[model samples]
Target: MRQEDIWDADTAARYDTPGTGMFAPDVVGPAVDRLAALAGGGRALEFAIGTGRVAVPLAARGVPVTGIELSQAMLQRLREKADEAAIPVVVGDMATATAPGEYTLVYLVYNTISNLLTQAEQVACFRNAARHLAPGGRFVIELEVPDLRRLPPGQPAVVFAAEPGYLGVDTFDVLQQHLVSHHFTFDPLITGDRQARVGRSPHRYIWPAELDLMGQLAGFDLESRHADWRGTEFTADSPGHVSVYRTAGKPVSSGP
Candidate 1:
């Protein structure tokens, strides 16, 4: 199925887990804090701003926010939280679509950029973010560093999350830098039976150095990188990173 189909209405309807999971205040609060600070009192733009997860709260912090999203279903979910005046969104591919007005901050969180699934598209995404950003503006991305080290020799899969009734695993193809995240949920039915649901999404994993090269190609300077939203130190041992890039000039196809 197409990536759009994978994030259909049904998926959007069940995407939020209020007060828990990704929606937990601890998770969302720090992210909003960091993004708001990066916005520096100027307008902000979110790429793949699904369901107003961070936008709504960031707006509550007084930043003018706009969004570009591919999934209409997810946009609908965002509308339920904030109207067009509060958070206007353009429906199209974030790598190519343009939203009105310049922004001091352009952000893609939760590893959404990986959803583009290819190197060219991901590079385009950085360029697009640069396009929307004002001079001196910043582009931030929260992404996991590929977890290939966690996989046992000759093994392609690694378990990342295991909760009471949910499991998250990632299978990798190092040759292609391809990853498919598999989610399995077990829910107890009214009849005391457990129902199982499975989901899989493909992503192209980029390493830190490769991400920096993409930024350079798009005329951005790597400003700072942290291990988390709280501004923890980033190290080789870190599982993920929050990278901040400042726009410097027009993108270039070839290095100088």
Candidate 2:
């Protein structure tokens, strides 16, 4: 399946349907708060804002948030939620989207960076974010720690079941640093009973050190790193990785 198809309207509408909000509150909310504090009460940009889960709450806290999203369906859901809660958003691709003005804080939350399938696209995302940030502004990213070492040698697929009857089978192409997960639903009636709901999301997982290199390439300095939203110590065993980067005076011409 194509990358664009995974986040299209139909998929976006089902984003928060069931068994998906676990990470949103515990992981995403506090991270956004930290990013907002870094912004020092100025305007902020949320890359890949889906359904306004984090954006709406952040806006309710009195922070004016401008969201950039590629899926019209996701943006539509976001707009509906925003209208109910009164927030604003911008619809576009995150790797290349340009906002109206420089922001004090630019953030890509919920492992959204992995949505970009290649290193070049991910680097472009950092560069584009730098372009939208004012001098001294911060760019925050939240992602899951890639567990490449856990994969058994010669095994190409790993099964991840978030719950009974709902499975995500992940296939990795190590040479390309690309991974795709097929979401399978056990219930066939809603989806023909015998057939599963298949959705593929392509991702490129980068380590904290690699992300730091990307930040340096984008003319940003690593400000802080955290294990979770509550500012826990970041260690090798941490489940989540949070990194805050400060936009330096200028942009870097090259690197990856």
For candidate 1, the lDDT comes to 0.90
Which sections of candidate 2 miss by over 4 Å?
17-20, 23-25, 84-86, 249-256
| Cα lDDT tens digits for candidate 1, 153-215 | 999999999997789999989998998999988877521356678888999999999999999
TM per model? 0.94, 0.89
Clashes of 1: 0
TM-score of 2: 0.89
* lDDT of the candidates, in the order given: 0.90, 0.79
CA shift of 218, model 1, Å: 0.4
Q: Model 2, residue 80: displacement in angstroms? A: 1.0
Clashing pairs in 2: 188-193, 189-193
Q: Count the backbone clashes (under 3 Å) in each candidate.
A: 0, 2
